[model samples]
Target chain A: MEIIKIENLSKSYSSLKRKNNVLALDNVSLSVERGKIFGLLGQNGAGKTTLVKILLGLTHPTEGRFSLFGDSTNNYKNKKRIGYLPENHRFPNFLTAYQVLYYLGLLSELNYDGLKRKIFEALELVGLKGVEKKKVKTFSKGMMQRLGIAQAIIHNPDLIFLDEPTDGIDPIGRKEIRDILVRLKNENKTIFLNSHILSEVELITDNVAILHQGKLIKQGSISDLTAIENEYRITTDSELDTFLSKSDFVNFQLKKLNGFTYVLSGTDEDGLNKFVDLLRLNGITIKELIKQKLSLEEIFISLIKDLDKVK
Target chain B: MRNIFIIILYTLRELFARKLFIAFGIISTLAIGIIWMILANGSVMINQFGNANPGYDEMEKIVLGFEVSAILFLSDLFILIAIFSCANLISSMLEKGTIDVFLSKPISRTQLLVGKYLGGVTFVFINMTYLVVGIFLVVSFYFNLWSFTVLLAIPVITFTFALLNIFLIISGLLTRGSALGMIVTYFYFIVLSPILAARDSISNFISSDILKQFLDFLYYLLPQVHDIVKTVFKQILLQNENVQYELLIYSTIFLIAGLAISFFIFEKKDL
Candidate 1:
């Protein structure tokens, strides 16, 4: 089931004195499904956070429509099932970790009887079980981020929105949070995350949408977005540098990566098969022939660079 | 309702942790201690004043007069300190981005704002009650005269602060800082409201009727803080036979209208 649906959502910010308004989101639309991790990728000020805020009702869309859990109205009851950890979020500095979670849990309308256990469980999941009594002012940035996450999931929300959840976290903590998100997804919860860490998003997200300057430029599953067409990284037992120097290789584009590995590109699968046949006939035993793929960061940078060049 | 109550508790906890609440508590204790010391030395006080053998009625009047002065002084001080301390209740949340967590909750924007408004009012009320009741208890114990009239200052003073708090909250929302709210609220209470309340005497020197009418309009439009405090004082001294209950009613209406304005601003705010 579609957990969140937004269509033609746009947001513009204007000051009375400023003649030109800032378009934060322009005709953005996307949906998150149940039990999947959907990542929103963007550079700073690319309207990723604006979109999340609009969906969570922290801000209203200037134009278009959105629905949460199939209900489009401004019913606050939908928020009970949703959790959000905003970028740069802060809990009351004087509150202990436990107190912060307890209060936020109560705000989510959790019964007081079970809130204590849930707080503990959330703390443990975020690896903050021991410092539940320490005031937030004394916590490190990473610790505060953990407490933020704990509060986000303390009520066991069905849909969680985390903007830069792994921000300020160490590599180990990031991995732990990624595991927690996966576990939540396993329990059939939807996760909508906005992140600048492309590698982390590439690793855990089932699908991703990239925004550029208030516009969505690319969006799809990781494999689909990164898959290079009609390209293969072929590894062989025999050297290809000397062989390619002598062979007629006009049927495809080939670049020798090293001793026995070459990047082979062609117009179609037939062209790829012809190159494979030529390699077999030459007694070059094929060891690996895998489709080439780009890293998410590479695609993101290229897309952004390409757009910048067009402007 | 549950969410609003939780925010209130959260706000109270925040006030406690900030140590301002404790600071007010300590000040109240000292004030109460001073009152006790003064009332306990009634004979010595009268002797020092050259009235060594005062009758029971004279002593009671003197003590009640002293008590009234102290209560008024403390009440004024309470309103000032309360306004200063509660000014940042909402602005700090916005500055630190903690309001996003609140606005994302299952509560409406109106509920969140009301919770914050009440939380600040409750914080001031608790401190005012502590100080006022402490003074009343000490004075009543010394004189063996139970005057319930002075206890009424708690709600009256708190109500006055509650009305001013709307200005603070609105300013906090608009400016995203406490300084503007603090300055505006203090300016209104200490300068503008008092000047407008005494406009009738000032009007004699002014020739322009339009300016006087504008002043009168302001007096009627604003929360009648000066007038309400004056009426409460008269009632406490038992000098007011015809209590201006209309002042309280007007202030109450201003409070509701101010709250509605706050809700309107907050509901449409992007954050």
Candidate 2:
């Protein structure tokens, strides 16, 4: 089921000193499916925050329509099922971690009867079990981030929006948060993750969308986005140097690497087969041949650099 | 309703955490203590004024005058303090990104703003009541003047504060900072309102009818805080039934319009 559906969403901010409205989100459209971790990848000023704000009703959309839980109105009822952990989020400094969760949980309309238990559960889930009594002012960045996550999930919301969830978190804490997010996904809850942390998103997200300059340039399953077309990495027991010296292989391009490893690029799958056959014909014993794919970080950097070039 | 209540509680907690609530409480207690000490020696103080044995009516009048003076002074002090303390009520939430959390909850922007506004009013009301009722009891016990009319100042002062707080809230929302709101509120309360209240007398010196009409417009357009306090003082001291209901109605309308404007701006504003 589509937990969130946004169509032609655009937002522009007006300023007294500027001649033109600053476009924050430009004709962006996307949907989040239930029981999946959907990652929204963007650089700074890419309107990632604006998109989240619009969904959470923190701001009005200048154009387009969006629905939450299949309701186009985006009323308060839909918010009951939605949870948001905004970047740089702050709770009242004087409030203890327990109090922060309790307050937000009450705002979420959770009854006081079992709220204490929920607070404890959420704290423990975020690895903040015993520190619930400590005031937020004394908490470190990681602890505050954990508390933020605890507050976001204290109501057991069906759809959670986490912006830069691992920001300011140590690697170990980041891994723990990833674990909690995966656990939530396993519970059939949809998670819409807005993050610049490509490696973190690469680890857990089922689907990813790349946004650049307020425009969604690419979006799809992670596998499809990262897979290199008609490319394979092959390792053989013998090098193909002698074969390369005599043959004019115009159908494919081959580059030899360290030892017997070679990167082969072809026009299609049939071309890959022909290359494999040609290598085998030359008595190059094939030890391994695997399809190649780019890391998410590499893909993100490449996409952003490509866009920058176009600009 | 529940969400608004929770936000109110949250706002109160913020005030308590900031120590402003405790500060207001302590100040009220000190005022009460001072008033008790003064009223306990009411007879001796009157004797020093050449009145050896004042009648009950004279004593009531003297005590009522003193009560009115003290309340007026204390209400001004409390309003100034309250304005400064609650100035950051909305702005801090925006600066720290807490308002986003509140807006994301199952509550409308109206509920969030109303809850915060009521929270500020409730803070000021609690302190005003403490000080006013304390003085009322002290005077009632010492002078035997059970004047129920004195209690009216509690709501009147609170109403004035509620109106000023609307300005603070509007400024806070506009700039996302407390300094400008605090300054504008203090300016309006201390300088602008008093000057505008004297428009009729000040108009005599002004030759231009347009300028005089502009002064009248400002007096009527803004909250008539000075006039309201004057009316309240007359009612408390003279037992006057000739109340200016129009002033209250106009101020109430301003309050409603201010709140509606805040909600409209906040709802559409990009956080």
Candidate 3:
């Protein structure tokens, strides 16, 4: 199901004295599906957070339309089924972790009587089980992030929006949060995650979208966005150096590590196969070969640079 | 109802856990202790308890007067602390990014703001209960006299402060900085509220009818919180029969209008 759909959305900020309008989101649009872990990527000030804020009704769009679960974005009731963990989110240091979740859960429409077990389960899921009563001020940054996630998922909404869920988290904590997200996804919950940690998003997102200057620059399955179609990384025994020096068959080595292996990328299968055949003709031992794609970070950087050129 | 109540609780929890609440607690205790010291002296206790010198008057009335004096004096101090405490309620929430968590919930923006406003008053309410009631009990015990009228000032002073709180919350939302919010609120409190309260007296001195008319207009329009505070305290003391209706009316107007505007702006704001 199309859980979220946005069309031609735009948001601009202006100050009366400035006399110039700052365009934050410019005619951007996208869709999210139910039960899919969708990742949103952008550099700072690219309107990634702005778009989320609009959908969450934290801000209104200047011009556009959006709907969630076939309901208008302005539908108040739809908010009950959604949860958000804002970027750099904070809770009062004075409250115990449990108090924070209990209050937020109540705000999410869960009764305290019914929410205790859920809060415990969530804290446990976030690796914060026994520390429920610890004051939030005493919690480290990573623990706070985990608690933030716990609050976001406390009510077990149909869709959850997590902004920088793993920010300031340790590697182990990041892995733990990833596991929690995976577990949520396995329960058929849709997750809309935004993060600067590309590797983390790359690991779990079903689909990825890149936003640049309030514009939707790229959106697709991670495989498709980062995929080098029909490209192959051929690992051979010590022939890359000579191949580069001799240069037969139009040289298509993406990278050559230690003069043996080459990440051979080509636009089409024909080009890839041609390079492979030439490597075999060189009589260099073919140790192994496998198809590969660019990392999400690589694709993200390239897409941003490409967008920069057009601007 | 549940959502708004929870948000209110959420806000109250934050304020209680903060250091300012603790600071207020210590200050209230110390102030009460000082008041106790003054009451321990028999002469000051009997003579200075009431506005008039202690006489063969009923102990209840004299004790009531003393308690009323303490309530009024502490209220002045409380207002300062309350303003400092509440000045950051909305401004800091938005700036520190905690407001987003609440905004994303199923609750309305107005609900959040009102909840926060009430939550701020909740802190004031709790502290006043401790500070005001404690002072009342001590004076009654020390002087061997009991009076219920002094207790009435609790709610009266609180609502009056709530009326003043409107300015603080509005300034918080518009300015988005704690110091700036407090400065603006204090400006309204110090300058505008006072000017509006003495509008008639000042008007009599003005030579021009136009300036006097402007003063009268400003007096009615601006939230004369000081007027509300003073009149309510006087009413509690039973010293004034001419109750100032503007205290209730103007305070209510300022609260509703300031709250309405703050909510409207916050709802449309991008957090």
lDDT of 1 by residue, B123-226 (tens): 98899889888998898887777767777777888888999999999998888899999999999999999899899999999999999999999988899998
Model 2: per-residue Cα lDDT at residue A216: 96
lDDT of all the models against the reference?
0.87, 0.88, 0.81
Model 3 CAPRI rating = medium
- Which candidate number would show the highest lDDT if scored against the true structure? 2
lDDT of 3 by residue, A1-311 (tens): 99989999999998897888889999988999988999999999988889999898888889999998898848666778888988888887778999889888888888757788998999988889899988898999899888888888888788999999998988888888899889889998999998888999999999988888888888999988887775677787775765565445454546675557677654367776666677678776789887788999999999888877887
The alpha-carbon deviation from the true structure for residue A32 of candidate 3, after best TM-score superposition, in angstroms, is 0.9
Better of 2 and 3 by lDDT: 2
Alpha-carbon deviation at A30 in model 1, angstroms: 1.7
| Per-candidate DockQ vs. reference | 0.69, 0.70, 0.56
Off by over 4 Å in 2: A236-255, A267-288, B48-51
lDDT of 2 by residue, B1-271 (tens): 7877887898899899889878988998899899888867876878876897888888777777888889998888899999999999989878747887877788888888899999999888888898999989987887777988888888899899999998989998899999999999999999999999888899999999999999988887889888888764566467668767788888898889988899887876778
Candidate 1, A28-131: lDDT as tens digits: 88888899999999999999988988887888889999999999996888898989998999887778898888888888899989889999999999999899
What is the iRMSD of the candidate numbered 3?
1.4
Candidate 1: Cα lDDT at A198: 96
Q: Which stretches of candidate 1 lie over 4 Å from their true place?
A: A239-250, A270-285, B43-66, B236-239
lDDT of 3 by residue, B17-91 (tens): 677679888988998898898877856556554544545456666677777777778888888878988888877
